[model samples]
Target: MKNVILTQEAPAAIGPYSQAIEANGMIYTSGQLPIDPATGEMPKDVEAQAEQSLKNVFAILKEAGVDGSNVIKTTVFIKDMGDFPKINKVYETFFTESYPARSCVEVARLPKDALVEIEVIASNNKTNIK
Candidate 1:
């Protein structure tokens, strides 16, 4: 069975998509923009933007009953490659040992002109404390 995940802790989907979906013991999240769920605004710097984006991703994962350690893979999209290191620093705060495999790329643009966006895939077996 497939389950659609939704939570008020993260920014709502801007389009016709669920925040995440779970099936076959795996949870897949939609790319999360830096928009704050309460303010509907993005932070100014790459570090803050990265943090917010990952927070949104984490919220969805939490709603699906998993955590960062359960994640097996991730994909990040950024408006600029120059912000990679800054974003990576924030990324480290969210994930620990046995980090999930990830692919990050610089893109020409992003929805709402967000500086960073992140999505993840996680197993539903266990949760990790952040």
Candidate 2:
């Protein structure tokens, strides 16, 4: 069976998609924008944008009983490649020394024209991810 992951700590999905879904032993999260769940606002800078995006991704993982350590892979989308270094600095604060595999690409634009967006695939370590 498939389990839907939802959390108020993360921003709500803007389209017809769940925040994340878990099946078997894996949890796949939708691309998370930088919009803050509480303020419904996106930060202006790339560093803050990356932080917010990761926060959203983690919130979904938290709902599914997982965390960054359980993440096997990640895909990041950014509006400008030049902002990569700044984003990386913020991203590193969220993970440990042994980081999950990641791929980041420069995109022309994001959903809210935000500077960054992120998504993750994590392993559900517990028996029940309710």
Candidate 3:
């Protein structure tokens, strides 16, 4: 069975999509923008934006009963390649020494003109919950 994941700790989906979905021992998260769920506002810089985006992704994962270490892959979308270093710095703070595989690309734009967006795929293999 597929389980939809939702959390108020992250911004609600603005369209026809769940925050994440779990099926077959895997949790797949939708792209998370930097919008703060409390204020519904995007942060001003790439570093902060990346932090918020990852936090949102983490929240969704937690709601699915997983964590960053469970993640196998991630995709990062940024408004500028110039901000890659800054974003990477923030990204590293989230995962451990064994990092997940990642893909990052410069995008023309993002929802709410966010500086960064992140999505993750994580394994539920350890807990075998649902």
Candidate 4:
């Protein structure tokens, strides 16, 4: 069975979609932008935006009873590839030694004109439990 996950800790979905969903012991999160759930504002810089986006993703994971270490795969979308290094710096802090598989790409644009966004898939398996 599948369960829909929602939390005010993360930004509200702007459309007809859940923030994340859990099914068969796994959690799938939607693309997270830099909007601060508390303030409903987007950070100005790419680095700050990246940090906010990661935090948003983590909030969803926490809402689903998981963490960054539980994540198995992730997809990062940036408006400019040149910002990869900056984003990576903040992104690396979230995970430990065995980092999750990830794909980072520069897209033409992103929702809300945010500089960066992230989506993650995490597992609730024994091996990944913290």
Q: Top model by lDDT, which number?
A: 4
Report the C-alpha displacement of residue 47, candidate 3, in angstroms: 0.6
What lDDT tens digits, residue by residue, belong to model 2 across residues 6-67? 99999999999999999998999999999999999888878888999999999898888877
lDDT of each: 0.91, 0.89, 0.90, 0.92
lDDT of 3 by residue, 1-130 (tens): 9999999999999999999999998899999999899999888988988999999999998888778878999999999999999998899899877789999999998888888899999998765322
What digit string (tens of lDDT, one per residue) describes model 1 on residues 22-113? 99989999999998899998999999999999999998988887878899999999999988999999999998898999999999999998
Cα error, residue 65 of model 3, in Å, equals: 0.9
Q: How accurate is candidate 2 locally (lDDT)?
A: 0.89
RMSD of model 4, in Å? 1.4
The Cα error of candidate 1 at residue 8, in Å, is: 0.2
Candidate 1 lDDT trough over 10 residues, lowest sum: 121-130
lDDT of 1 at 28: 92
Which runs in model 2 stand beyond 4 Å of their true positions?
127-130
Each model's TM-score, in the order given?
A: 0.95, 0.94, 0.95, 0.95
Top-down TM-score ranking: 4, 1, 3, 2
Clashing pairs in 4: none
Off by over 4 Å in 3: 127-130
